[model samples]
Target: MKDWNEKCAVVGIYNAYNASILSYYSLFSMQHRGQEASGISSSNGEKISTYKNSGLVTKVFDENTLKKLQGNSSIGHNRYSTAGEDSIDDCQPIFAKYSLGELAIVHNGNLTNAKKVRKNLIEDGAIFQSHLDTENLIHLIAKSHKHQLVDRITDAINQIEGAYALIFLSRTKMFAVRDKYGLRPLSLGKITNPDGSVGYIVASETCAFDLIGAEYVRDVEPGEMLVFEGAYSKHITMPKSIKIFAANPKPCIFEYVYFARPDSKVFGRNVYEIRKKMGIELAKEHKIKADMVIPVPDSGVAAAIGYSRESGIPFELGIIRNHYVGRTFIEPTQSARELKVKLKLNPIAEIIEGKEIIIIDDSIVRGTTSKQIIKILRQAGAKKIHLFISSPPTISPCYYGVDTPDKSQLICANHSIEEVRDFIGADSLAFLSLQGLKNSIQNAGEEKFCQACFDENYIEDLQE
Candidate 1:
């Protein structure tokens, strides 16, 4: 299924003997976040070394590449370009040299005011090397008058607007900071070294901790900065008014809806469990008679199962996804995209022949994919097709990190529910209510979720 891709995933490790290797594994686990590029930077006491390329993490970093990035502290990034052209320079863990020393930075989330910041910096004669907003942040840090790297980062952050979960590395220290609103997520983990010493890790999601045998400690609070000096981690506070609008965090609700992996615990809740709850809620909202409930595989599996259990409809593997299918949205032309959709999923004729099927999906972005799937099911002789979405209608484009289509391109943003159902050729289409979506996820306090894509109640002032 084609869905909005998350902008990136970040991992930072300190005081570990084979920091680069661990980072490699961490990025490997979160490869779904960004498939276009992967990178890692390691600090070996006196200088920082980096290796990055456009490809999957396993394809980009082999044993030889990891060996070259030797250090006891490292930072890594997996990127799907949201703001910049996909190029060598845009692949992250972007390094820069300033008067202080060598510094490298990796970030997740978009800086909504980066265009303004870039214009101002250009007027001040700052030379930017890449088109990425990440590079804009680097320029900000490099120009700060503060002598200490942490202080410089804090100063730079105060000047920027919008969501960020950033990790910055100097030769001796590693720092992790979250945007004041916490529109994106970053987690802290603790692991034991081979020598039994403790090491610290920070990643976009807790699933990264599980793969590396680290125990999750807690989420890095919104507006908080964590400094890792050798084996110790400390909280650092900066100037007032750094917070723009939100007094507390408002993490992107879409993380639970689609972006995050089911295995991940994002924004303090298990994604799989939350997705299942959403499915249960969807089932309650829209009662339907169907022989079986099927998911648009991989992302929609959990929700489909929950719907099946709650509605007394057995779940079956009606539509199977081709594991090796390339991302269809990235295909260049209309014909290529249409062909890609057919190649990516196929319905089981035997199971679908006479059965009334209910297809459960996270959200409908453009409705093209949904239309294709319904057509395929009908061709396979499905008597009826009903589509149920786990989240409210996505009406606005997400400005934080997710690479969403423009509001004009979004089907729900323009068409009513009935119009969308007819457009996709489904007998019925139902979406979970906003209240049901909030109640489905555990600990998703009303104030903590950024539902801008659904309700357009953006936390940040988009006006310049």
Candidate 2:
């Protein structure tokens, strides 16, 4: 199946005992954001130390390993390659030693202007350690002649453009910043110990806070920088001169649709509720006759329930997904996709036999997985298959962090609705209208969202 992978997950903790262990728990909860590499860096009030490797969090760190990263302040990352080649050297939080001091950074979004910035930096005789965009950020911070650490970070970010939720750790303090557009999600959390001491957490999602018994604070504002010293944290505003996009903040709508866990609260709305509303809206937009409403499993479950409720169709587990499908599967191809469908999901012959099925899915990126799944259902005796996508058709490739297929490769970008239906071998196919999608997220707070994938409305300035 063609899966949509986000760039990474980041966690920062300040004034916490066993900061590395708490950071480990936070990263474990957000392992879904990235799977290629994981790392953590800690500051013990005297020196900054780091431990990182290319693997899952569980595989990268153990009990003794966390103990070695002793400190009351730490930052961590889980990475999926977007800006650079996947290798041990590219793993984060990338650490550096400079004239100012020791610093470590964990970043969660792609900088649209990184290449231009890197080129200019190289022209000035700056050396780069890795191809990762985060490495470029480290370089930017190092070059800034600003005396204060926060001022240097401010200077670095002023020159770059794109979506980012960044966490920076120094020998004495911790810092976090979200891009002006807020295209990615980041939240602040608080954990109170029995002894009345308070600890702070910053992560890519609130689910990370839930696992560690931390209380969810509010989201880090777009264009806002947060500084943490011990248990005290303060907010700093980005310079108004650097603001380039429309003044309105635009978050990534794909987070609610697919990337975030259903249990998460993103952009100030519950993801599960928003997805359910999306499914309901999709059903209202397209009324179809079907014997059962079945989901693609996991991602489609909440939306499928809403669809079944709205249409009065029976909801059944027509397809069972294998939870043990690992990253070591064979490379994806036409034949491999077919084989993968068989290995990943099995049709419940008793429920699907002779019944027309309406399969609800979040979105179809390439249409290969849906096509193969329909084939499997047909082979199991499904009389007919109709596909309903909860979100609008994805027609543009995302450049602000998501690892998506190029525009030329996106099925919806290249084909019409009927063409996609035919290619997927479905009896009929319908996608949620753009307006319906907008209505579904009415409760997602005052900020607008980046719907570039649905409509070619790039929100950021991508030109060099």
Candidate 3:
């Protein structure tokens, strides 16, 4: 709860050879998006088959389970439980049997109007099966009087409000759509089959495409739906695009700051380049003199490099993270929480001994982690510790699928910058300004983004 939790990952494969295997690889590449559970649904122009469980993709499915999928089209999900309770029923792709044949869906965002919609459905004598708002789609689609599945989907989406990058799988077709606000990312790709045919892949990140030997095609436009029909063997064409709503894109800005992989090209900009720019911007804003610059590891490496280059400070990988650390079921005691931090990230005493160091980090939520980090650095003989945050303070919680702590739990929300610095035991602390963040991206043109966590500007009414 202290760390900024993650959103889910959704992927769809249309007409690909061994579609379920490709879906498994795509989900594997995007494991950072979610790690709680993974599942895949496949259709071979007959009955739909789905297999999923509460574990990582590797543990959830093996060769035997994937062999049973038997389909040329597939949809997959990796969940971090932004909306529903952590249960077997909540794992996706949520399979259902309705009047319109068999259908399965994978979703990647939160529904802000879930309460009101669920209330109306229950009053209308609809029995629910799961805690997921995604299940609401199944109910709404099943209840629709519309004759065609496409029309029914439009009707169902019209009734919901919030962030969603959705992929719906049917017996012979696949559909991908993003909410009008586009608060989550979804990209399109093309895969060349061994038989000289072309298949299409859609995923939450471009890195998924790379892993499965798929080439990036573009992002799925906001407020648009792509309907994939016909087999890929003969007539391989683009998915039919339906403009469900007038374009009003407001993609999530935090994708660049934290969630997305550095190698990804989100919203057509390289994530690593944008992150480096954020670091350069932070360095320009704060001209603190330090003996050396150190990154918090992994997430902070790019930004620390930018800062080091800008400030002429030597950059060192002062912290090393344990890649093998897995979550422990029994939560550590409050007094012993620092041990958990130590287990994950440890300082290099040789690099920090008697040195005035600047530590670069992406963002601070509860301040506990940063405090523990600073404590370890001091014990390593750091003379002065200056903490530099790459992004602006997270002052609000995210309702657009990201799992963030409430405002009351956000240390930066209630405390002044200096007060936070004192609490973290850092000699100096500074965060990137909103203007500086905007200046980091190049030629962002005519595009709007959702930075609600930093600005408290909720795009859609949370109560809606």
RMSD for each of the candidates? 3.0, 3.0, 1.3
lDDT value for model 2: 0.87
Clashes of each: 0, 0, 0
Writing each residue's lDDT as its tens digit, candidate 1 over 1-464 gives: 36688869999998888999999999999998999999999988888999999999999999999999988899999999888887898899999899889999999999899999999999999988899988887888889999888788888888888889999999988888898788899998887888777788899988899999998888888888888774423221221223323447778889999888899988888999999999999999999999999999878899999999999999999988898976455646767756777788888999999888999998999999998888889999999999999999989888888898988999999999999999999999999999999989886555667888999887757432
- What is the number of residue pairs that collide in model 1? 0
User: Model 3: how far is 439 from its true place, Å?
Assistant: 1.2
Of 2 and 3, the candidate ahead on lDDT is 3
Pairs with steric clashes in candidate 1:
none
- The most accurate candidate by TM-score is 3
Question: What TM-score do all the candidates reach, one by one?
Answer: 0.95, 0.95, 0.98
**Worst-scoring 10-residue span by lDDT in model 2:** 236-245
Stretches off by above 4 angstroms in model 2 are: 231-247, 329-333, 444-447
Best lDDT among the predictions, by candidate number: 3
Q: Give the per-residue lDDT of model 2 (tens digit) for 311-369.
A: 99999989999988875558867688678778888989999999999999999999888
Assess candidate 3 and give its lDDT: 0.91
Candidates' lDDT values, in order?
A: 0.87, 0.87, 0.91
Q: Per-residue alpha-carbon lDDT of model 3 for 389-453, expressed as tens digits?
A: 99999899988898988789999999999999999999999999988888888787655788888
